[model samples]
Target: MRKTIALLAAAVMATPAAAQPTPGVRMPPEIGAAYGRLGKAMMAHDAAGVRSVWAEDFVVNSPNNEVLGREQVIAVMEQDFLDYKGFRKHITYVGQKPEVTVIMGYDTMVPIKGPGAGKQVMRPFTDVWAKRSQGWQLIARQATIAEAR
Candidate 1:
């Protein structure tokens, strides 16, 4: 509940357009490396590997304005990998701390060949990952429809 409250406040406060990372600026090694691990895990459909990246009190303020908890978002993650031909992240900024990092980026999905191919997309995401004793665990996230460049 504490985490949820804090996350809600974060969502209300953040102005991501003003916060966009400059193009070509790299993310921190800690964040890029950790996200790389999670990316590989997703491609492999390893539920446990994916779960390891989430904090116990994870929360997401979704594009539709709905709030989701850890279990719910994990289920969504699993389903997304299963449903899409490929889903990938391109990180733009990674704000770091000894124990916390806020990662902001875009995500692309390549749908399985069909009427759906190249027909759908979701992008521009922000995720807050906290380094715990076990490792980097995602604590918060927000994502929205991709905007044309």
Candidate 2:
């Protein structure tokens, strides 16, 4: 009876990591994996998959107050990815605290349609990940557009 109870407790504890959304700030192994999947999904233009890496209350700030829900966020991200052809992002893991993660990266996306049609603009991006019940999910993200020198 004791062993069975203990096993059940363990399973219950691990359930969230197995199925919950990525944590908000903490980048544990599961959280990191989710983020990695998210980046790949973004590159592949998979909106639903990308949004899964974010928490339910995710806020994105690209110099705009685009506070959106999970669905809305996915829609915006999908549109952005589709509109920008050569979208490339190089992410660097800066540091991690108890409940937050700081990542610094640069993104280059072509604004035009065809290949090599528009200018390749590079912008610095910072995303804050939070550790939620699920895993490491993105809580807030911001980017500043800059011209490559």
Candidate 3:
């Protein structure tokens, strides 16, 4: 047991630090910053701005279990323009270590005034952002129903 432990430690130490974690698993700060841009754009309901952060070939697996490509996704956003008045999103990245992973968050819309002022409706969502040659772009996303999960 002692000999095996020594060999294991030696093998681990032999590997380079940059390769210490799994391949492509390194989470760079740039990715986080790019993700922030996405959040801000979404919060602002800037359809063009949101699409700008998405890869041209972006695809999304919606909570409805349908797959939508870039144009379709944007179309949905355009529709959302008709539906939502104003909203905010609270995003929390899922799991430890980035790699390619799902980012989860809550989408909330609050009534500013009138009879139901301050009332809010919240929806949960998940998104996948990948670092490509052009930098971080949203490759996929989904809106989730908590109870159904």
Candidate 4:
């Protein structure tokens, strides 16, 4: 696939760097800062800030459908905030693998008004981050909505 090829190319290009992080290794501060900013943006409904952490070619699949590209993701994020008055992200895990790290988290959003207002909704989240030349880039993400207990 073209996307696969491009990802491979990017990975290959990053291989020769003098400071290549060991594959499958975990780094706390890097991922921590990432999630920190992500949380901030989500709470503030800052679509631009949220997209800043994602790669240009990022892709996300939510309960409804798939969002392709950074721009699309931003649009979907904005819609999410508009639909839910307050949303919170809870990071559950950050697993390291040979070439990428996986982040597992859950989000809860409280609807402000309208039909779903006053309801608390939860969504399980996951992200696959790759260490690129520009640092950690979130390449893929997926989530499913859940009923809050």
Q: Rate the local accuracy (lDDT) of all candidates.
A: 0.58, 0.53, 0.48, 0.55
Cα lDDT of model 2 by residue, 1-149, tens digit: 33322212111110111222223433357555765677566556676776677777876553333343556556544554234455565555457788887876666665443223376766666777888877788877766556632
Write the residue-wise lDDT of candidate 4 on 43-65 in tens digits.
56677766666777777664545
Off by more than 4 A, model 3: 1-32, 39-48, 79-86, 96-99, 111-119, 145-149
Clashes of 3: 0
For model 3, residues 1-149, the per-residue Cα lDDT tens digits are 33322212111110011112233444445655665565555445566766667888777555445566777655544443212235444544444344465556555554332222345545566666676777667676665433311
For model 3 the local lDDT of residue 50 reads: 65
Give the Cα-based TM-score of candidate 2 against the true structure.
Answer: 0.61
RMSD of 3: 17.7
Per-prediction TM-score: 0.67, 0.61, 0.54, 0.65
Model 2: CA > 4 A from native: 1-32, 64-69, 78-86, 112-117
The reply for model 4, stretches above 4 Å from the true place, is: 1-27, 43-48, 77-86, 113-115
Error of 4 at 52 (Å): 2.5
Model 1: per-residue Cα lDDT over 1-149, one tens digit each: 43333223223122211233467766665555666666566556666866776677878886457787776655654544234434555668767888888877776554443223455554678889888888777888887655422
Question: Which residue pairs clash within candidate 4?
Answer: 24-97, 24-98
